[model samples]
Target chain A: MARKQGSHSDITGPRVRDAALRLIARHGYAAVSMRQIASEVGIQAGALYNYTPDKQTLLFDLMRGHMADLLAALEAADLQGDSLSRLEGFTRFHIRFHLPRPDQVFVSYMELRNLSDENFAAVEAMRRTYEDALESILRAGEAEGVFAVPDPRITTMALIAMLTGISNWYRAGGRLESDKIEAIYWDMVRRAVTA
Target chain B: MARKQGSHSDITGPRVRDAALRLIARHGYAAVSMRQIASEVGIQAGALYNYTPDKQTLLFDLMRGHMADLLAALEAADLQGDSLSRLEGFTRFHIRFHLPRPDQVFVSYMELRNLSDENFAAVEAMRRTYEDALESILRAGEAEGVFAVPDPRITTMALIAMLTGISNWYRAGGRLESDKIEAIYWDMVRRAVTA
Candidate 1:
C-alpha cells in the first residue's frame, strides 16, 4: 500500500507508546492487551499492529527506548571535573531524570521479567552500561585516594539503588524540593564512598 | 457447608497463598486470575473462594501477612548493644532477611500501586513501624555523638532502601556469600552514617 503524506502513523506512534507505558505501568505488561492499548490510544485494535508486530515487541521497544534515552541523556549530561564532582553530578542527574518519570521507572524495573530472554538481555546490557558509568567514577576516586570503596561493583549497585529508590516515595510539592533531596543524597553518597 | 477435618481446604489454603504469591510476583497481581491461582493449587475455581473471598482480600492478606511477619521477625532479631552496634545489627539483618525472600520484596514494593487505598494505608503503617526501628537507631547514634546523620528520617529511608536493594541482584551460590555481601554493605552503611 502506498503511504499518504502526514499519515496517522507518525501522529499515533507516540500516543501508542505513551498509552502503552501508562497502561503497562498501571496494570502490568501481561495483563494489558493490544485492544486495551489501542482503546487507550483511541485507535482500532488492528491498527496497533501497524505500529508494532505484537505486544512483546511493543514492550521491548518501550524498554529499549527508555534505556537508549537514558544513555543518551547521560552522555549529554557532560559529567566532568574531579571524581567527586562527577559523582555528585551523576547523583543529581539520576534523581532529576527518574523522579518525574515514575511510570517509566516503575515499568522499566517491574516489567523486565515479562520481556523475552533476548529483550531482557538487551535491557540488562543497557542497565550495566549505566552502572558502569558510576563504577568508573568510583574507580577513579579510589585511584586518586579520595574514596575507599571496598567493592566498586557493589557500591555502584548500592548507590544506584539508593538514588532510584527516591522515585518510590518522592512527590511534587513535597516538603523537600528536588534540589534539596539531591543535596541530601549527594552528601550520603559522598560519605559512603570517601575515605 | 460443614467443615471436614483434613479436607482440601486445609491442604490447599497454604498452597493457594503460595501459588498466588508466585504467580503475582512473576505476572503481577493485576494479571493473575483466581482460576489460574486455583489451577496452580490443583483445585477447582469455586473452591478457591473457600480460601479467600476475593482477589482483593487475597492480595491484602498477602501484603498484610508479609508486613506482620516482617514486624514479628524484627522483634525476634532483638537487636542490642550500643547505638553503633545496633546500627550494624540492622544493616546486616536487613540484607540477610530480604535476600532469601526476593519474590516477597519485589511484590511488596512493585504491587503497592495495585493495593486498595485502605489496604495501602495499612501496609504503609506497617512499613512505617519497620522504618521507625531503624530511625530509632539513627536517633540514638546521633544523640550519642557516634553518628552524624543530618536527617535521621532521610537516612533511615536511604539505608533501608540500600540494604533492601540487595535482593534485586544477589543470587544464591553467586560470587559472594550472603555473609560477605552483608559485610560489604555494613561497611558502607557504617561509613554513610558515622561521625
Candidate 2:
C-alpha cells in the first residue's frame, strides 16, 4: 500500500495541480469544487483527498509553488555583472519566465483575495522577496552612479507590473516574436531607470 | 403600473449594477449568482430580471459600464498641449481616475474571461478605443522627434499596464500621497519615451 501510494503521488500530484490551475484560472478559486478537480484529473472524488487536504490547500499549494518556481528560476538564471547588466537580465528573465505560465500568473493575482490570511501572508512574503531582488539591483545601480531611481520600491513595483503585464496579452503566433518584444521592453526599462 | 415600473427601474437599475459589481469583484463571476446579487441589493431573485435580462447581461453591463465611464472620463480630462505634455496629463489622469475605482478596475480586467463572445467583442472595441488614444499620443511624440517609441502599440500597452497596476496596491492613506506618486510615475514615463 505504501509503494502504491508513493507511485500515485509521483504522477498524480502534478496532474492535480495542473487541473486545479486551469479550473481556477477559468472559473476562479471560489467557484471550483473538489469534485470537478477530481473529475478533471480522471480520479474518484474520494481519492482526490489523498493528494491534497482540501480546496484551500490546493490553492495555497498552487500559489506557493508558483512563487517557489519563480524564485528558483531567478536563482538559476544567475544574473551577473554590473547593476545595469543585471537589470537587463532581470527584464528579459521576467518576460520569459512569466509568458509561458499565464494560468499560474492569472491565478496568483486574481486568487489573492481568496487566500486565508495566513496563506495570503506567506504568498505576499514570497512576492516581496522577489520584488526585493529587483529593488536591490536598482539600489546597487543608484550607488554605482548609473541609475537615478528616486524611489527604489516604487520603481520596482512599476517595472514588475510593466513586465508581468506581457503575460496578459501575449500569444505564441503574434506579429512580434518574444525576442522582439523583450528588446522593446528592455529598451524601455533601460531608459526608464538610467541616470 | 407603468409609472410604478418606471419608479422602480429608476432606483433599482443602478442598485442592481452596484450589487453585481461588488459581488463579482469579491466572489468572481462564476461564483456569484443572481440570487446572491439580489440578496446583496435587497431585492428578490426574480426582480433582478427587471434590471438585467440575465446574469451574463449583468456581467456585461458592469464591464461595459466601467469601460464606458473610463472613456468618458478620459474625454473629460481633455488632455491638451504638445505630445510630451499630453503624455504627462495622460499618466496623471490614469492614476487618479483608476485609484478611486478599484472595484471597477478589478472587475474590468478579471471578468473579461466571463463575458460572452458578442459582449467580449463589444468590450474589446471600447478597450481598443482607449488604447488608440494613448497610441496616438505616442505616435505624435515619435513624429515630433520628442520620443523614441519603436512601437507605439506595444508602448501603449506597457505604459497603461504600469499605470493601472497602481490600483492593485494603492490604499486610501499610504506613505506617498496621490500627487507624489503621480510625480514619480510621470517622471519615469517622461524619461522612458524621451528621445
Best by TM-score: 2
For model 2, state the Cα shift of residue A64 in Å.
0.1
The reply for model 1, stretches above 4 Å from the true place, is A1-7, B1-10
Candidate 2, residues A1-195: lDDT per residue as tens digits?
Answer: 678766968899999999999999999999899999999999999999999999999999999999999999999999999999999999999999999999999999999999999999999999999999999999999999999999999999999999999887899999889999999999999999999
**Model 2 chain B: lowest-lDDT 10 consecutive positions:** B1-10
Worst 10 residues of 1 chain B by lDDT: B1-10
Second chain TM-score for model 2: 0.95
TM-score for candidate 1: 0.95
lDDT, candidate 1, B17-133, per-residue tens = 999999999999988999999999888999899999999999989889998999998899999999999999888778878899999999999899889899999999999999999
> lDDT tens string, model 2, B1-195?
678766968888898888888899999999999999999899899988888889999889888888899899999999999999999989999999899999999999998999999999999999999999999999999999999999999999999999999987899899899999999999999998999
Where does candidate 2 clash, by residue pair?
none
Report the CAPRI category for model 1.
Answer: medium
* Model 2, position A150: C-alpha lDDT score: 97
RMSD of each: 2.6, 2.1
Q: How accurate is candidate 2 locally (lDDT)?
A: 0.94
TM-score of each: 0.95, 0.97
